[model samples]
Target chain A: DQQVKQNSPSLSVQEGRISILNCDYTNSMFDYFLWYKKYPAEGPTFLISISSIKDKNEDGRFTVFLNKSAKHLSLHIVPSQPGDSAVYFCAASDFINTGTASKLTFGTGTRLQVTL
Target chain B: DAGITQSPRHKVTETGTPVTLRCHQTENHRYMYWYRQDPGHGLRLLPYSYGVKDTDKGEVSDGYSVSRSKTEDFLLTLESATSSQTSVYFCAISDDRELLGDEQFFGPGTRLTVL
Candidate 1:
């Protein structure tokens, strides 16, 4: 069974508009959530993160919103630019459950395209 | 940015052959991990090491083995390759001294194809 899921496989948005990506998790033990962006032939780079204690976290034009009650989270990018186009992955960790290490569970991923 | 490199970035081998991939890191992080990325599976953990000489299996450890003899290196081996095992493999490192947010730095990747 997939613990984390990204329902949408792809998303397209016009440049200068807002882009939204959603993710859902089945395990309630997850306490920390993170987002990573990947370009072709490259490793993923950290974009933003949010703790379960808080409902939202923002950095520049990227904002991450968490709804613990719904076990869902969304990433919002305002004024999306063509450079923002890439694959986005959502990951969650449960430090308490994985006693020794904070092992992560990643969602499939969503491909984002910012059209000109 | 994490000073990590994966060897044999691209390889092709026939079934039943043995293959090993290397991961070297300069960060000297205490934790190293092996993951495989498939089209529909996202990224699945194969094995991980918390320290030199200490390794453990992950969600998808079958048909694979791992070794961590030194602090800066980790190895993943496939005893007998199979077509089903063809995928992009990634290596990641983490430092326990940092926060417990589970942030991991990844290497480029190694694409292996089993014919």
Candidate 2:
């Protein structure tokens, strides 16, 4: 069973345009969410994240909006750059500190293309 | 760009062969994880180690095992390779604050092709 889902396989947008990537989850226990950017032949790097308590979080040019009521979240990149062309993965975790098995559940991923 | 390294970045092996992938870290983090990335299955945790010799099975632990003798090294071994096991393997590391909302750093990944 896929606990997390990224419906869009790929997306393309022009430079300086806003890019929105969507993701969904079925589990309600997930308390923290994260997005990672991966490049070819390289490991995924941390992008941004949001907590269940908050509905939105923003970084320099990236923003993550979480809708706990709908079990959905979206990543928005303002003025998308060519360097943003890569695969973005959405991950959810229960975020516990009990020392039990704590792991992040990831979505399939969405490939974003920033065209000039 | 965390201090994580995965050895044998690319390998081709046959069925029934035993293969071991190594992950080395320099950050001295307490948490280490092994994950496989496939087409449909985004990334599934194989097994993880919290400390030296302390390990636990992840969601998908069949046909695979892991060992962490030191804080810097974590090894994933396939007892008997299968065509189904062919995928890109990633090793991630995080500190004790992982559960407190810290992100994990991933390795470059190892592509294993089992025929």
Candidate 3:
């Protein structure tokens, strides 16, 4: 079963504009969410993350919004640059404790393209 | 990009042949995991190791097996390759599991093809 879903396969935006990618999860036990960006021929790298206790977390150019009620999270990129063009994977994990190991559930991913 | 390396970056094998992929890490992270990436299927976990000699099966661990004899090395073996098993495999590492998902760094990845 696919606990997480990213209905959009791809998205396009102009450079210096805002880009938003959405993800939905079916498992209610998940307590943490993360976004990873990947380029061609390379593995994904960590971009941003948000805890269930919080609604929004922002980095320099990336922001992650988590809505626990709806079990949905979104990644927002402001003034997106051409470098931002890549596949974005949304992942979630359930909380146990600081010492316990948690496995992540991932969505299919959304390919974002930024053009100048 | 992490301190991890996957051997045989690209390999093409025939069906029913035994194959092994190696993931070696230099960071000495306590947690290690193996995942496969396929189009429209995202990343699916195969198996993971929490500590040396400590391992567990993931959602898609049927045809795969993993072993960790040392803290820095994790190995994945396919008993008999199948056409459906062709995919890009990634090895990830993380230190602690935080309230918000801990960051897991991925290796360059190994692309395997079964003919």
Best by lDDT: 2
Maximum-TM-score candidate: 1
**Interface RMSD in Å per candidate, to 1 decimal?**
2.1, 2.3, 2.1
The C-alpha stretches of model 3 lying farther than 4 A from their native spots are A95-99, B98-101
Q: What does candidate 3's lDDT look like per residue over B1-115, in tens digits?
A: 5799999899999999999999999997888999999999999988898889988888799889999999999999999999999999999988766432477899989999999
Cα lDDT tens digits for candidate 2, A1-116 = 89999999999999999999999999999988999999988888999999889999999999999999999999999989999999999999874354643479999999999999
Off by over 4 Å in 1: A96-100, B97-100
RMSD of each: 1.4, 1.6, 1.8
Q: DockQ: which candidate is best?
A: 3
Q: List the residue pairs that clash in candidate 3.
A: none
Poorest stretch of ten by lDDT in candidate 3 chain B = B94-103
As for candidate 1, its clashing pairs are none
Predictions in order: chain A TM-score: 0.95, 0.95, 0.95
TM-score against native, each model = 0.97, 0.96, 0.96
Candidate 3 is graded, for docking, as: medium
Query: lDDT tens string, model 2, B29-104?
Result: 8889999999877889898888899888888999999999989999999999999999999999887653535588
Per-residue CA lDDT of model 3 for A1-116, tens digit only, reads 89999999999999999999999999988888999999988989999999889999999989999998888999999999999999999999864243476778899999999999
